[model samples]
Target: MFSDFIELIGAFVLVLAILQISSDRLFFSVKVYALQSFFVALSIFVIGLYSSSNDLYISAFLTLLIKVIIIPFTLFEAIKEMKIKREIETYINITNSLMIISSIIIISFILTRYIDLGGEIISKKIFPISLSIIFVGAFIMVSRKKPITQLIGFLTLENGIMLAATSVTYGMPLIVEIGIFFDVIVGATMATIIIHHINETVDDIDERTVENFEE
Candidate 1:
């Protein structure tokens, strides 16, 4: 019963990831990412309860704290400081993005069907979702021009990796999970600082502007 619920939450997380790809509003994308993180944490907590793993519990707490609360708070503050209210610039239109996301989802399921997950039902259910989330995150980073949006994509990619770890192994060791959390926090902080500097120097966060630096 619990496993089914957690899988349902995982499915919703994938939907949220797809929504992020389809939406152009930067703030909306960040909020969707936060909600996805919250669901992922919930899924982790459920898995810990089912597996009786204290380490998974700790990982879930850390996920809730860092991904759900701290990172989103930092992004929101950065958005406020930058006074950014414009929609994200995307290389493709929304319809095309949606079509691509759909294709990715179909391909993920097809590709996973040939791979073995050792007869773990939950792993079988989540493997495709995690892979699709990762692909969508990469697509978001490639298709969007805003630095903040790309940062969100990177975070989304990390979230997919965490989901995969939990699905495959019921979670990694506490120390390893903590290390990953630390890296994410530091990376997010550094990225936020870089975005601020880019905004100040170029007066824009568009990737094209930053890449065309003369010197």
Candidate 2:
């Protein structure tokens, strides 16, 4: 029963990833990413309940506090400050991007069958979906033109890694999780500062604009 709930949360996280990639609006994507993080946090909390692990409970609270609340709030504020909306362009159009993402999901499922990961319950149930989220996140970063969108992609990728860790080993130690949370907060803060600087210099947040400005 608990395992089923965990799998449901994992599935929802992956679906949110797909939803984010399918859309082009930065605000919408940020909202979707928040939803994804909520599910990821829920998964941790549920797993903690199932196993009765205090560390997992603490980790889940931190995930909720950081990923869902703090990060999204910071992003929203940054977007308001930058005064931007949609992504300017993408390397791959929505149609092709969706096709590529579909292929990624199928490939992830296939790969899961061949990999051996002992008897981890989460591994057995939703590892493929977690893997799919990782690849989808990376794809979003590469295909999108704006740095803000790319930042969302990076956060999604981190969520996938977190889900994968939970799947394979029931999550990392509490101290390690705290350290990672600190890194995420710091990395996100730095990225936003750099994005602000880039926007100020180039009058655009497109990565190519920064490169051309450098030239």
Candidate 3:
């Protein structure tokens, strides 16, 4: 029953990842990422409870406090300060993006089938879902023109990595997990600062505009 619940949460995380890619609004994408993070934390907490791992519980708590709360709050505040337009510019059309996402999911399942990770049914099921999330997150980063959207993609990718760790090993050491969380928070803060500077100078948040300036 707990495994089933974890799988459900994993499925929802994948759905939110797809939604983040499909969204045309930056704010909507950020919110979707937050929702995804919340689910990821919940899934981790569940795993910790079932496995009786205190380290995982701490990891889940950090995930909730940082990814679910602090990161999104910081991003939203940055957005408001930048006063950038909400509409996201994308390289690919929605139809093609959705098709690509579907293909990614299918391919992830196919790829994971050949690689056995012990006998745990839950691990086998979640491995592919986590891979799909990572792939979709990378696609989002490449397909979107906005820095904020790309940031969301990066966060999504990190979430996938976290999920994969949980699924494969049950959980990493508490110190290691704390370090990962710290690194992410620092990276996010730096990225937000850079975005703010770019907005101040370029008066736009689009990556294409920044590229043109470099050229």
Model 3 agreement with the true structure over 95-136: per-residue lDDT tens digits = 899998999899999988988676554556788999999999
lDDT of 2 at 118: 70
**Which scores better on lDDT, 2 or 3?**
3
Please give the TM-score that candidate 3 achieves against the real structure: 0.94
Alpha carbon lDDT of each predicted model: 0.85, 0.84, 0.85
Could you tell me how far off, in angstroms, the CA of residue 95 lies in candidate 2 after the best superposition? 1.3
Go through the candidates in order and give the C-alpha RMSD of each one to the true structure.
2.0, 2.0, 1.8
TM-score of each: 0.93, 0.93, 0.94
Point out the worst 10-residue segment of candidate 2 by lDDT.
Answer: 204-213
Q: Which wins on TM-score, candidate 2 or candidate 3?
A: 3
Runs of candidate 1 with Cα error greater than 4 angstroms are 119-121, 204-215
TM-score between candidate 1 and the true structure? 0.93
Q: What is the lDDT of residue 61 in candidate 3?
A: 89
lDDT score at residue 45, model 2, on the 0-100 scale: 85
Candidate 2 clashes between residue pairs 3 or more apart in a chain or in different chains: none
Better of 1 and 3 by TM-score: 3
Candidate 3 error regions (>4 Å): 119-121, 204-208
